[model samples]
Structure formats: C-alpha cells, structure tokens
Target: MPQVPIVAAHWVYLLGVALIVLTMIWRANVVVPSVLATFLVALAWTHSPIAALGSIFNASFTAAKELFNIFLVIALMTALLNALKVLRSDIRMVEPFRTVMKDGHTAYFVLAGITYVISLFFWPTPAVPLVSAVLLPAAIAAGLPPLGGALAIAIAGQGMALSSDYVIGVAPGISAKAAGVAVSAAAVADRALVLSLITGSVALLLGYFAIRKFITKPDDGLLERWQAKSSNGELARIAQEGTFDKVELARGTAGDQTPLANQGQIDKALAAIPDAREKWSKIFAVVTPLAFLGVIVVMVLSKLGIGHDLKGGDAAALVGGVAAVLMIWASFVTDPLREFLDTSADHVTEGFIFAFKAMGSVLPIAGFFFLGAEQGLSAPILGVPAAQAPNLLFELVQAAQHWIPGNQVFVAFGVLIAGMITGIDGSGFAGLPLTGSLSGALAPTVGLDPATLAAVGQMGAVWTGGGTLVAWSSLIAVAGFARVPVFQIVQTVMVPVLAGLVTSTICAVLIWH
Candidate 1:
C-alpha cells in the first residue's frame, strides 16, 4: 500500500471537481472530465508523460470488472420480467390490486403501494408498463390525475424500491463491495430498507397532499385530462381494442381468417391457458408473493445458520434463478411446445437490450470514476511515472479526512449528499466505489457502520440516477409511456422525492446511530 502523501494531490482533484460541477451546471456530460481528471492526476503524480495513455484503457477495464455484476443482475432480472410478460404472468401478477383501486384516492395510494412492492422485486422499468397499462386507466376512470399516477410511480418505484435494492441487490452489492462488507449483512440491508421506506413514505404523503384537491370524482372528463397528458397514441391503440378486448377477442378464435382475423387467431393461440385468466391470476397472486417470501425465508434461515450462506452475487443468482424457473413454468404451462421456446428467447433478447440501454452508458462514465479508485486501474487512465502508483480518489479522501466533521449524522448525510450530487450527472450507480470505499475509510474515524453509511449513499445514487428525479435518465421513458411532459413529471415528483430523502436520512441517523 502506498503511504499517505504529506502533500496532497489537491490541485488535480480540485480541477476534477470543478470540471464536473461545470459540466453539470451546463447540463453537459461529465464523462470527459472524469477521464481527463484521471489522466491529469496520474500525470502530475508520476511526472512521466507516457503513462497517461495506459491509464485510460486500464481504468475502464477496472470499472467494467467492478460493475459487471450490476449489469448482469439487471440483465437477469429484466430477462425474467420479460419472460413473465410473455407468459402473461406479469399481468396476472398485478390483477389482485385491481380490487383496491375502487376510486381516485384509493387508486393513487394503491398505485404507489403496488408499484413500490412489485418494483422492489422485479424493478420499476418492467413494472411501469404493466401497471400503467392495467391500473392507469382504472385510476383515471376513478379520478386519479395522470400526473399524480406518474408522481406515485417516481416516488414508490424509482425512489423507494430501487434505492433500497432488496431483491436484486445491485445497489447494495455495489456499496457493500466497495465498503469491504458483506452484501447481506443484516444491519446494512435493514437500515437501508428502513431508510428507503421512511423517505419514500414521507415524500409520497407530502406529494399526495400537494395534489389532494386535484382529485376529482369518477368522470369521463378525468380520462380526457389523462389522455391529454399521457402518450395518447399508444393508449389509443391499446384502447381501440377496448378494455380487456384482447382477452375477449383471443378467447377461442378460429384459425381460418385474413391477417386481422389471423391476429385474433394468434392472440387466441398465444393466449393463456383455459380460465388462465382467473386461475393464473390467482397463482401469480400466491406464487409471486410466496416466491419473494421464500427468498426472505432463506435470508432469515441463512441468518439463523440453517442453510447455505447467501450474500451479494450469490443471493442475486438465487433470485434470478427462481424468476427464470417461474418464467419457464408459466410459459410452458400455458403453451408448452410452441410458445415456450419462442417467448423465452424474445424476453431474454429484450431484457438484454433494456439492460444495456439502462446501464451501458455507465461503462465510459464509470471508467472515469474507476480511474480515481485504485492505482491498478489508473495505470491506463493517466500517463505517469511507474513508481508513483496510488489510488487518486482514495488518497485524496485520506488527505481530507483530518478536516471532515466527526459527527456520525454529519458524516452519513455528507456521504448521502455527495452521492446525490454525483448522481446529477445522471449515472446514479456510477459513484458507488468512491462512496463505498470512503465510507469504509471514514467509518473507522466517525464511529459509524461502514455498511449503513454505504447504504445511505446508495439511496442517493440510485433514486436520482434510476430515473426518479432526472429528466434525462429513465424518467423520460416513464414520462413518454404516461403521455406527460418529462419536466412536468420532474416538477410533480420534486416535493415527494425531497421528503423521502429527508425522512430516510433521519431514519438512518436515528436507527444506525
């Protein structure tokens, strides 16, 4: 290990921070700054011109290594979700919530609650269309504003479910890995989950009040507003068939027909098994919940020393495997021979596409952060003297450790806020290794749990970057699907997101402290 330097690489780091801030202020990408910063730091430290060239390649490769698991987790979960959709189990999964959405107020809360729950397991990207397609129209008919529905989703799914990251464990795993802690550490997951819940609940409550008076009685007028703001084109297309018309049209349609008629035949052909409408719906209600519950059971059992020790990537593999199995069973049971193989392939393909779209941007971006992480990675990021090998960010943080406040809450919130600011670049998960490692190094001094602090940092990173707050992130797709202005979605979600952050911070301080 390189000894801490008496003279810090302050100027180099300052330049990096300044560049990042400038990029953010101008709404420009900071990837170049991240790369340039790595180069400068390495060059300045080593004072050799040639090493900068190598630093770039090695830094990105290091980043890819650290973050590949996150990409894989996303790919697997997304694939499983796609498979479920093809099997029609995705629709069946949410059917029970229909009963709770009898009116506007109920619909708003129901949407939030259901979105939060499902997004926790399967994630929000997949859950969004499923919920919006089914529950949204009902919510509108019940007088829930389309904007309100969008806000609820941003708060519950993107903010809460993702930030906590209980099921897939991507966020937590990244944080935990960086902090040198186990991914399934009880204290870590518990605190993160609680903080996420607190923030999400408070934000959602405040947000609902902000729009309370906007809720109207059930009316066709509400649908007009919903249509006016939402992606009317897609909704119109889905509506042309009328509510549940696909199900009806697909019911026992004969094979002999024209293309349109053939579509009905195909729909019937691919349609779920007999009374699958009711039966599969019930099964999903039971099995999906039970499957997740089983995960919890295994977690508890592992905690109690009864089963195989599962943590981090292992836990994720288990969850993904279960989802895949469910997909296979569901698809096969509906139409074992024909639709099974075809649907599985399509779902996996779509899943990979989505996974890349959601996470691929991070490669270059994270390559920038990884440069500051360790010298091994930085070798390619900065052209430097071979003898002067040190992790730039780690070294910088250590140099500043003397000046950092000693309070636990201050330390925790500082990491949280820093993570949030880092997320402003729109690659929310990009800053984890820095934050996590800092938390570990800082934890020893501030008397805080490294895992807990890392978890808090994760919430800031993921909720913002996962598309809840940022217009440029996944929020755009959400807004498009909802048929609303992206900025409108941001403004609507601002209050709730702020509330969630505050509440979650307080919860973390109180509980973890």
Candidate 2:
C-alpha cells in the first residue's frame, strides 16, 4: 500500500496539540488554543477560510453529540443520588461502611474501595457526589484528613475505575473503534481492568504513605477545623455578595452555619420521620446497593460467557436505566405520589446543571481532538470526502515511524505519552480514540499487541487527566466535596500517579510482549 503523505496540515495539528499540552502544564486553560488550532489545521487542510470557520463549530457540535451520552449518564446518576438524599437513604447507604472504618488507615482504603466500586458502575462524574457527600465526611470523621479523603476518591474513582471502565465499556469502546481492531472492546476492557488495578494500587499506596504522617488521631477537632474552614469560606462568599442578613452573619461568626448543617438537619428530619417511612429509607439503602450489585453480577456472568455480553453504549444504557428506575423509586418513597413527578424532575434538572458545571468546558477541547480523529464526523466538517479525510494525528505518527525507533519499549512509552498529552484537556475518554488509533497504527510496526498498547495509553490518559494529576479535571469535584484546595489534591496525587503510570507502562511492555 502506498503511504499517505503527511501534509503541512498534519504539522499544524501537531503544533496545536503541543501548544495545548504546554498550556496545560502551565496550569492555563487550553480552550482558546484548541479552538485556534482547529481553525488553523482545517484552513491548512481545506485551504478555505469558510470551511475552516465552519469546522470549528462543527468540531464542538460533533464532540457534544459524541459525548452527550456521557453527560446523560452523569445526569441520571446524579439525579438518582439526589433522590436518595431526599429520603436520607444516601446517608443510610454509607452509615454501615463507616462502622468498619474505625481509623485513618482503614478509612482511607474503605473510602477508596467503595469509590472504586461505585465509580466502576457509574462513571466517576456521578459517583463523586455520592461518595463525597456520604463517605467523605465519614472518612474525615474517622481520622482521615480532608485531603487524604479527596486523594482516595480521585485515585480509586477517576484514576482506577474510569481508566478500566470495564462495566460501562465506554473507554475501551472508543479505543477499539478508533483502532479499527477486529477484536471486541471486551478484549481491551479486560486488559485495561488489570492495568488500571496495577496503576491504582501503586498510586493509592504511595498516596496513603505520603499523607499518613498528616493523619491525626480520631478527633472531633479535625472535623471542626474543616467545618470552620468551609463555613468561613462560605461566609466570605456571602460577604462578597453583600447579601448576608445580621442573623446570618452572626451565625457565620460562630461557624455554626457550616455546610454539614444541612446534613445535620436531614438526620434530624430522618429521626422525626414515621417509623414506616424511616424503614423505607433503610430498605432503599440496602436495596439500592443490592440492585447495583446485581447489575455487576450480571455483567460479570456475561463476561464469563454465562450470558450475552453488554458492550459499549448498551452497558451505559443499562446503568442509566437502572439509575433512572431507582431515582423514580426513591422519589416516590420520599415525596407524595402527586409530588414525585415534580421531585424527580427537579432532581434531574439539578443533575444536569451539576454535570454541565463540571464538564461544560470540555466540549470545545474535545472538539479540537475529535477533528484529528478519523471519526466520520470530522471529514465532512473539513470539506473532504470520507475516503480522503485526513487523520492529522494518526498520519503524523505514521509518517514519523521511519525516524522513530521500532522498539516495543519506545513504542509503548510513546503511546503512553501521547495519551497523556491528549488527556491534558481533562476529559480522559476524549483522547482514547486518538491514543487507540495511534496504538493500532503503531503496534504492528513495533510488534506489540494492539490491545496491550491501547491499555497502556488508557492508563496514562485516565490517571493523569481523569482526575489525579489535573486539578481542572473532575479532581476539582473531589476537592470541593472534601473542602480542600484543588491544587493541594493535585500535589498530593502527582507523585503517585506519575509513578504508577511509569511502573505500569514498563510492566505492559514486559508482560504483554
């Protein structure tokens, strides 16, 4: 087959990607550069300013369309969590777990384990709220520092569970599809699961040790400190708005209006509930976890070939459907039947708002990357026929193969670095296709298994951009919930995440080859 020529447009795309990475490293927003890069690359490729302008808009539109399912899943899961909160079942759900988490060490692992499990079924975007709201407080109260609690959630949920994405299969699906691999995403998913565990374990252990010295004895004083900090922070915001009433200001002065006050009120209300209603809360709490457990069991059986496999979007749909049903059930239990509809609607709206707040900035960034992918949507936007559509990133990698060493070690690390660079935009899944495509293209040349290469890239991308290393990513959500500065969480996890990625990449080259 004749080699496709790399054009100036390809270099422009590379420059754009490089610039974006540089901006991220500088802790700056990359959106404007991404948008500009998209325009420049499109202009170079099509040589039409009109086409390039349209491509910018088309890129974001395509990204939103491609990733809307992720947004929907996040919304549904958040809505479900909110509904559970209404019945105080969210508290009930984690109350038992708190009993076993008696100290800082135990609390850290327990928090991580629960966050991992929940995040595996529902992506971390949704799982964060549930874990943060319930488990975070309990973990802190059990002697874990707030930053420690945030690290656990970030490592387990965003770094570990999302990187694997075995249950939902979204991450692997993107990779497999982009790679044009004949194998099902299940093949990649299995490998990713193992790699994610390896990475998560190393990172979590390192993280725990790094913060263990800061772990104080189980005391109310630590919790009070965090509460006072949160209250003072809120008071500052209220003061800036100049909206505080005298009574509110006085309450804030006493640090009595802490964020946990809402939870306290909910606990009081739960206590005041009729015995029948209260039983329902406990029942839903138990039932909710079991329902999700059942889903996992079914998926596991399917993975073992006992039943049909749930792949890609289907798996996400299964999770979303389950969450929706649970949301309705919880809403009905918590509110009058007539009000349940409104209650559910309110929850769903709130969930979408939260989802957008967390992820709205990702769309344009995803768009820029999507344009470099061979996803069919980009070709038309660039005013090229499907057959002639340029995959700028893939072509650049392909063209550079001659000069690039063919060693498997080099190839594996290259793919890992590429994935990490793509992850700079903070949507870990967004870059999977680019990494997957590169892995597929380069694996043959390097004589490595494409699946292994894909898995390696997945680890680097997710562990960095998914949340652990990047404060602008979903790590912020964990930070917010833990009431710590986002950068503090990033600093805490940086060494572990980088170490984990390096160790896992070496392992992938050695074990898989």
Candidate 3:
C-alpha cells in the first residue's frame, strides 16, 4: 500500500488527540481541550481564523446531527424507567431477585446478574440506582462486602453491560457511525455483545474469587456494618459524576419537575378509585417486562429469518417506539385521563432533560473527532468538496502504518490501546469517533475486517471509560451507594476489569477474525 503524506492538519490532529488524552489523565473535563483542539485543527486546515471559527460550529453541529439517534433512544428508555418509577413497579420488578440471593456467594453473582440484565435494558444510569437501593442492602446482609457489592455493580452494570450497549445501543451506535459505511451498528453490536460477555464473565469470576475469602455467613449485622461505614466523604460530589453518567441519581436533580403537574386531577382520580393505582402498577410491572422480552424474542426471530430483518437503526427504532407506547400506557395508568396529557409531557420532558445533562458534554468532543473522519464530515467542517476533502486522520494512520508491525494481533492491540487512551476522559463515549476511524483506517492494512477492529476499539473505550476503572466516573456512584470510597472501587476492580478487557480484546481478534 502507498503511504499517504502527512499534512499540517494531520500533525495538528495528532497533537489535539495527545492534548485531550493528557487532559483526561489530569482528571479534568475534556470538553475544553476538545473544543480548543477542534478550533486549532480547523485553524490549521482552513488557514483562516474566521473559517476556523465557522468550522467549530460545523464540527459540533455535524456531530450532533450524527448522534441524535443515540440521544433519542436514551431519552425514551429513561422516560420508560421514570414511568416504571411512577408505578413503583421498578422496585417490585427487582424485589424477587433478592429472594434468590440466599447466601454471600449467591448474592455476589446474583447482584452482578441482576445488574447486567437491568443495565442492558435501561442502562446503568437507571439500573445503578435501582439495584443499589433495593438489592445492595440485601446483598450486604447476605454477607457480600460493600466493596464486593460495588465491584459487582460497576464491573457488570457499567463495564460489561454498557460496553456492549446491546439494548440501548448508544455506544455501538456512536462507534458504528464513526467507523464509516462498511461497518454497521448491528455488526458492531453483535461483536460487542460477545466481547462484553467474555469480559464480564472473566471479571465477575475473578472478582468473586478475590472477595470469596471475605464472604461471611449471612447475618443482619452485615448491613449494619456497611451502613455504619457510610460517611460524608465526597458523598456530595458523587452526584456530580452523573453529568456524564445519564442520571443525577443520588442528588435527585437530573430532571426534577413539580411533584404534581396535574395535582388536583391526579389526586381526585386516586381518591375516587379504590386501589386502582396499585392494581395498575402491579399489572403493568408484569406486562412491561413481558413486552420488552417479547421484543427481544421478535428481534431474535427476525435475525433467524423467521420475520422481518430489523437492521441496526431499525432495532433502536423498535425499542424506542415500544418504550414510548409503554411510557404513555404506564403514565396513563398512573395519571387521571383529564391530566394524562400534561403528566406524560412532564415525564418525556424529564427524559430529554436528563439525556442532555448526561450526554450533552459529548457533543463538542465528538465534534472534534468528527472533523477527523472521512470526507463526509471533514468536507463539511473544512468547507471542501467531498471528493477533494482532506482525510487527515486516516491519512496519518496510513503514513504511520509502516511504523506499526504488520501483524494483525499487534495492530489489534494497538487499536485497543488507542481506544482505551481515548476513554480516559471517562465519558466512555467521547472517544468512539477516533477509535472507529482508526479501525477503519488500519483494518485494510492489517488484512482484517474494519467491523472487527471497530468492535475491538468499542470494547476498549467503553470498558475503560464506561466507569469500571475511573474513580471520578460513574464508579463514584457505585461507591456512594455501597458507602465505600470511590478510589477503593477503582482499586479493587482495576486488575479484574483490565484482565477482562485484555481477554476480550484477544477473543475479538481470534474469534471474529
């Protein structure tokens, strides 16, 4: 393959990525560096401050356009979760899982299993609070150490489930979009699921082994000990991590609305009806789970050629549509007919607000990366014809390809490492575009599939930044719930999570290749 020449913009792009990584390592927000980097890169390319300023807007604008689908699905799913909360069904739904946690050993796996399932559906944003509030105490009483409980939640919910993002598909959607046309979200998601399971299984098993010695006989005092350890140590700051974590859970400030949007009508309806709300809550709890399960079943059948083939975007649409209908139904059940319109609007509004709070920070960072993609994004930002647009990042990769070993496995790990570096900012998602574009660029040179490489990159980015290894990320939320120090969560799970990531990367290279 011919080596592509490096240009001024290409050098600026590298420097920008390096500065962003350094910013993340310093534990600072990457938004400023990202914005600055985009401006500088644009300045280099266009050679005019005015054009660079315009490029900044175009970069972020283009990025938001590409990623709005991810935001929408997050909002709808979160809205559905809020509706479940309204019915109190979210609690009821998971209460049964507690009964199965008969002992400390069982509790560990049970907590992880339940977290993985819930996080897969609604994301760790909602699942963390739900599992921590309802299940964490029970798991603690069953003799799982608070730290153990925290590891289970972070490794399974945030690391494993979120890495794949199979249900919500936010992570994969971003990765696939940045990976270019040859790679589809469905393809990336499918590979991501396998990798996530591999990663989660290894980490969960190792975590259990690491904590098995501390597993005590079930005693009521266990919960007391755990609670006694809870202090105000950075508890207030824990809520702040939710800015990137999807919900301001502990603070209850993500999307707070009035306690009663239609207070009088709702009160009147509840007062007039005898146990109608409770009855509906119970009924919908059962129906809601079944409906989601059915959707999963249908999608599987479609994949098996027994029904219409739902592509990546189509799958997200299906999930979002179902969630909207379910939210409306659940809200209606909880709201008086006369007040239904206003009440449902409140829930949806809350969903969008929460979504923006959690995900809005990624727009600027994504914009910076988008400016480095293929002609479609860069041309718009650089104001060049598509055919003549600069492929700054990809060209750089090609120029440097000779410096990298030609071995696929070597290249695979390199991409994985690059992805992990990108994730240090802790958004878990802010790095997808860089890794995806790198994968697409490097795959042909290495005789591998871009989708496979993209999947590997996605795993690395998500598993690291999705909250498992970072103290300031959503791991703090887990620590807050378990009443442990945030660093303690990071330290305990660090090795196990790293092991899982390494194992998964190796598996991705061998299995998919």
lDDT (CA) per prediction:
0.66, 0.75, 0.79
Q: Which ten residues in a row have the lowest lDDT in candidate 3?
A: 254-263
**lDDT accuracy of residue 428 in candidate 1:** 65
**Which runs in model 2 stand beyond 4 Å of their true positions?**
122-150, 167-188, 211-269, 272-276, 375-377, 421-437, 449-451, 470-492
Q: Could you tell me every candidate's TM-score relative to the true structure? A: 0.80, 0.82, 0.92
Best by lDDT: 3
In the range 1-513, model 3's lDDT, one tens digit per residue, is 566678788999999988987876665678888888888988887788998888878888888898888889888988888888877777667767877878999999899988998899898877887787778888888888888998899989988899999988888877777777668998888888998999889999998888899999889787766766754758556545433543244234213321111224234433544476888777876988898898889888988988888975898899899999999998888888879888888888988888788778888887887788677878888777888777777788777776978888998898888878877766677778778888878888878888888888888888877788766566666776777888777877888888988898888878877
lDDT of 3 at 128: 80
lDDT digits (tens) for residues 91-129 of candidate 1: 556655766777889998999988888888877766666
Worst 10-residue lDDT window for candidate 1 reads 252-261
Q: Of 1 and 3, which scores higher on lDDT?
A: 3
Question: Which residue ranges in model 3 land beyond 4 Å of their true spot?
Answer: 1-4, 235-274
Residue-wise C-alpha lDDT for candidate 2, range 282-393, written one tens digit per residue: 8888998898888878778877878867765666677788999999988887778889889999989987886665556667776776677663756866867888787666
